[model samples]
Target: MPTPRPRPSRRRLLLQAGAAAAVQVVVRPAAAQEPPALATLVAQFAGPQKVREGRVKLEIAQMVDNGNVVPMRVTVESPMTEADHVTEIAVFNEKNPQRDVARFQLGPRSGKADVATRIRLATSQQLVALARMNDGTVWSDSVDVIVITAACLETTTSS
Candidate 1:
């Protein structure tokens, strides 16, 4: 006759293993998020085709006292005719919470391909303006502006 040995309970086994195992809590530094570049955002709209560097003018101050409301003007060289005109105009930024700031849709009937508005910038960076013509050609221009007071500033609380 042979004697059988009893198996330990699942709770008892976990308790015994817990005593020998070491628990560690690792804290990792939060990675800062960076916005995409102007080129990257333009490619998203016009693809990787070559964009002409002229015909589009970006009028903005070289230095801005406040980024909350920076005046901007975008004018494209076009006849504004039904045959040849500016189809779309887009504004982009290098460093901001959002890469694409504004987009305006226009046509020959709009009288002109010029747009004037205000935009918010997080910091001093390059501002790009792109225009898509009716001929399927894309034109662009950029301006570098220094912002004294940045927008989109957030307040963080420590735990």
Candidate 2:
């Protein structure tokens, strides 16, 4: 019987191996790094606007049993007028990396300066609601949260 064709030549095998290694290097996912604090995230994303306290209202549970879907609401006392309406609202979580979770933009037609949504928190920490008005002023409010079972923590720690 004819001897099986010798395996691919050594040079071809080495070239194939090198190509595979290159592909692996290219396909690897970005490395995970520690997430910044809520205030730092806000500062980075908020630009140069002056962030003022107490103009926005943030509502979150004092104790959250589940971190996967924590309820949050934000309201700003604005008339929603053509000239004075809220332009944007952003949510930030203190314990989560990339804490700026969601942003909503509103106009005069929105009728109210309020928004509600569920967000994920990595652990027990503070949550912040920031609102930007049409006149270039930024308002914010924050509330501390206590998470009994954080989904991210559980998943990361394999507990």
Candidate 3:
């Protein structure tokens, strides 16, 4: 004969319900809020909260064979001098789970405001690169890329 399973007690059921309710209360607000857009992220990145639409070069392939790891490079046209140099460079993606992709810090001694890296894309979308200068001015540029194989997309198996 098969052994019967014991039923949970009333107190145990109440405790579980209370815990679930607490979790819901904590998570509801976050779920209701939408993620910040790329422009908003750029504004937050800029020290003075001002952004110029160009002067930062964002280089990426127009079409990517795979989205798993796409090569990207950002080069800002700056002298990289003590009085005028690039302070930071931030990369943001439109369709990714997280908007911010990468951030590179540089100073006058660095001699250059360029960065190269591989980033994963969730899908075909536009990417923005913003550079903050030591003079408190922010510059930005964007590129559109088509990804054949998307990254971070969940594939479901049929039972």
Best by lDDT, which number? 3
- The lDDT of each candidate is 0.83, 0.79, 0.84
- Candidate 1 clashes between residue pairs 3 or more apart in a chain or in different chains: none
TM-score of each: 0.73, 0.70, 0.72
- Which digits, one per residue and each the tens of the lDDT, describe model 1 over residues 1-159? 899989999999877754433221112123523245766788776765678899999999977879999999999999999999999999998888788889999999999999999999888778889999988899999887777679976679999
lDDT (tens digit, per residue) of candidate 3 on 27-119 = 556434223587578668875667898779999997786899999999999999999999999999888887889999999998888899999
Write down the TM-score for model 1: 0.73
Stretches of candidate 2 exceeding 4 Å from the true structure? 1-36, 154-159
Query: Model 3 lDDT vs. the true structure?
Result: 0.84
Q: Using alpha carbons, what is the TM-score of model 3?
A: 0.72
lDDT of 1: 0.83
Residue-pair clashes per prediction, in order, are 0, 0, 0
Off by over 4 Å in 1: 1-36, 155-159
Rank ordering of all candidates by lDDT, starting from the highest? 3, 1, 2
RMSD of 3: 15.7
